[model samples]
Target: MKKSFLILVVLLISGMMSAQNGGNDMKKFESQLPQEGRGNVRVAYQGKAIDQMIYEFMEEQGIPGMTLAIVQAPYIPRIVGYGVTDIEKGNLAAAKTLWPIGPISQGFTAVAIMQLYEKGKLDLNDPIGKYLKEIPEPWKSISILQLMQHSSGIADYREQKAFDVSANYQPEQLVQMVATLPLAFDAGTDVKQSATNFLLLTSIIEKVAKMPYHDFVKKHQIDYLGLKQTYFGEDIPNVKQEDVTTTANVHQTFKKDKDYINPSETTTGYVEKEGKLVVAPTISPTSLKGFADIWASAENVSHWDIGLAGSVLIEKPENRDIIYKPTKLANGKTVPAMAGWQFYNHKGLMDIKGNVSGHSAFLSRFTDASELVCVTLLANKEGVDLTNLGRKIAAAFDSSKMGTGANDDLLYTYESLFSVDETMSKIEKVLKTMGIPVFAKFDHGKNAEEVGLKLRPNQVIVFGSPKVGTALMQENPSISIELPLKISVWEDKNGSVWASFPQMNLMAAEYDMESNPVIGKMQELLEKIVIKAASQY
Candidate 1:
């Protein structure tokens, strides 16, 4: 389950490709487009078929049931559902079939906090102690923003392997589990993705709103925003039998298959387990609320997205910015991930994803200066790559800038006054500073000499952190080709030396890795090392 949550975090921060050629085309299309409704817009696209793409992806990923909503802002959302909700009963998943959203609950929690802020009930900078007086000493100093951004130094409850997922834990019990442990880092100094953050935020919401967290979210975000099919529970509220999708462990069935026929070859239907169709085990919502445990149809989730993008849920539009804006530390360094949602600044996208025992979800909102578009996907299986699949769907609606071509060149270059050899030495020193092992060093100029050909001074230093590189490769093994990071130092004809290395973000894009805290840390380290290597001082 912890691994599933980690996967969710990774999916949440993976930024989409920016629109390169679509601006003018999109503008022209928008001019001719008809308005759909209050929070909906019609978007035009010339990309490949979206429905077929989703069908193929679901088939390939063994996703039993999925519901998707594509919202072209200021227009009615296009919602679709596929496959059977129940394997044995043959019930079809539909627009109102509720699926557990897992950690996407945090996004709602963040919105609730911001709603309170809009009403002047709380300040984001206020310490948790302000609302929850029982917060421990060091934790008392941690601000609400810190908790929202996962920079409060609070230990993650999931990190405690012994903690019972099967056993229902109350909000206070969850807090107490982590409250006694020493912080992972100084508050506000670093960001670590932790459900503990949202758990505390839930408590804060209750204290500030003078009601249960669920009540606050229901009154302010769901009912107020007109999310008719959304609810905070393991089961779909007021939905009987055929209305809600049955969550299944497709991954488990896939693993157990002996013949292992490709899912695409078989018709979409029940997931058979040893000649018997299997249904997902029921779990209680009370066990996962605040951190996980929110259920909604894709359409309802899209409605929530529309509400957020339009700032209709929060009275103060500016307060809504808090959801996607990164938290800045006292030292002025900004955490790349936002307080409530993971933001890709370059692409102007906000993302939220969740993966629990039997469900996975992804929601992305693209907001450029001119338009806002949202794509939401909810699935009743664990292994589907919702982030990539959602991007594919978004591209179908706006193909102007959606392919996997490296959006930006990976290479980051810095000029230095020192000669090529000196820069190479500096590169090695910088790598050493971070304990990244130097795997190999190649002097291209020397190789040229051996080949009896003259060449300019050029050297490449290969170094990497196995812990970091291995983690990346574990996610996508193909990334091994880009692993064991390298920095090249060369002297130009003008005698100016330059050091260059691949930016981790570009590498991540190339390898299809998500932008999680580990990747963010790797990027920070690479930037620091490259700059230090090229610095004259």
Candidate 2:
């Protein structure tokens, strides 16, 4: 019964792909695999097919192609589906099909860095430019933590407007993009996401290890883990055919974009569409959006393989029982694969360029449930909507009972949008809308008894001004209905207070974050609302 249900899920994803490309891209979804994905990742279920539910979702939704792999302990890793490779060709996708892993590739570099850390060759807190000297414009020191946490003020790769997608880049070229970028904020003071850090990290991996970045991972992790078929771009070799076969027939080469990859090249062949000259894939803002297609087979794809092949996971190896294990650190000490973000680790999407383009992907691990999931959506065209779909797949194991506990402030806040009366009435409504089953016995905090229940020093999702929406009045005054106001509620341990807020507001539809007037109003309204709510709310 579960197998049948799994097939249904794959078909849905494939169907979604067909709508956008107007091409018949077939998909394959697999569930259930050898227990301990490569050993430690057990498979819970497996499924695959052209019209499977997962594929159908992707196909009908206009997704070009996609792959889903999941694992539950003591079971074989599930190979969800490699939905269509091309919409026009009706090409089917298969498990183990190589798709560029995008940002999750960041995990590989991070691991390689950690391995170096174990060796004591480099410091995670070291300035990135120190490793790559040729970068043109230099910025202030950005600690490894800043890069890892996205706290560095460096402008993002996607934020730059002049970048060219088809242009190739050497690793040095990747470094140059941010060589001169002014720190977005002091390294630790702010948080902003950027791909430049990882690209630079890739370079650091090479500089410190002396071997190419991909080579170090292949020798140290993939090979040691016995993920014979798993490799990054062309650097991985010596794979068993069964381990890496994909029936997805997307052309290995395509109408190449001139700037697609210039400075840094991948193992995959990418030549100039206009000429035979070769260049490495250069990451540019244009290419970050990612291709619509993804590739990978279930053979080596499980959360376990992700743990071994990509970033550090399962910090407590002592917590797991696996038959095979990677080699000890150069110091002859076993390095613990420290876990991060207990329930959900992190997922990333990357565009194809060198070993990196035409592939959109994700990685997730439900640590407490001992479940892990990964999906790769590979195609020749770029798309940004891929994450919307990945999240749905991840939601399956997200364990709603756990409630994302990242910012406690967000979890406890009561003053979101809407009026006090309407908001209070809608608590049950909002909880129901969240999909996760929730029960909130409304206990208004009024008198002494009620006051005890209220958490003081609230988590306030604050904005600086109330004027952003006034300009929207120029476009339409009703916009005020969704005014850019602060959403804050306090929690007090004694009389002390704490603050927290939602990030979604920055990207919400009602507020145009890019527009200064809108942003200012939001800041004003958010602060005013937050202050008012905190004092009397």
lDDT of each: 0.68, 0.42
Off by over 4 Å in 1: 1-47, 234-238, 242-281, 406-537
Note each model's CA RMSD in angstroms. Answer: 16.3, 15.8
Candidate 2 similarity to native, TM-score = 0.49
Candidate 2 per-residue lDDT over residues 1-537, each given as its tens digit? 999999998998877776754543221212343323234222111222223445544543344555566544434445544445434344445554555555544544555566677677887668776876765444436656456555556666645665555554454554556667677666555444566665666667788889876577677766665663355533323322221124353333223543222111112312223322233353433233211111234345453345643234324343222201221222343311211111111212111111344443445433333334444333332322343234344433342321222342222221222233333334334334433233223223443345565422232221222343455556666655544433433333322122224433443444554444444334433333333332211
Best by TM-score: 1
**Candidate 1, residue 164: how far the Cα is off, in Å:** 3.3
Q: Score every model by TM-score.
A: 0.64, 0.49
Worst 10 residues of 1 by lDDT: 261-270
Q: What's the distance in Å from true for residue 288, model 1?
A: 2.6
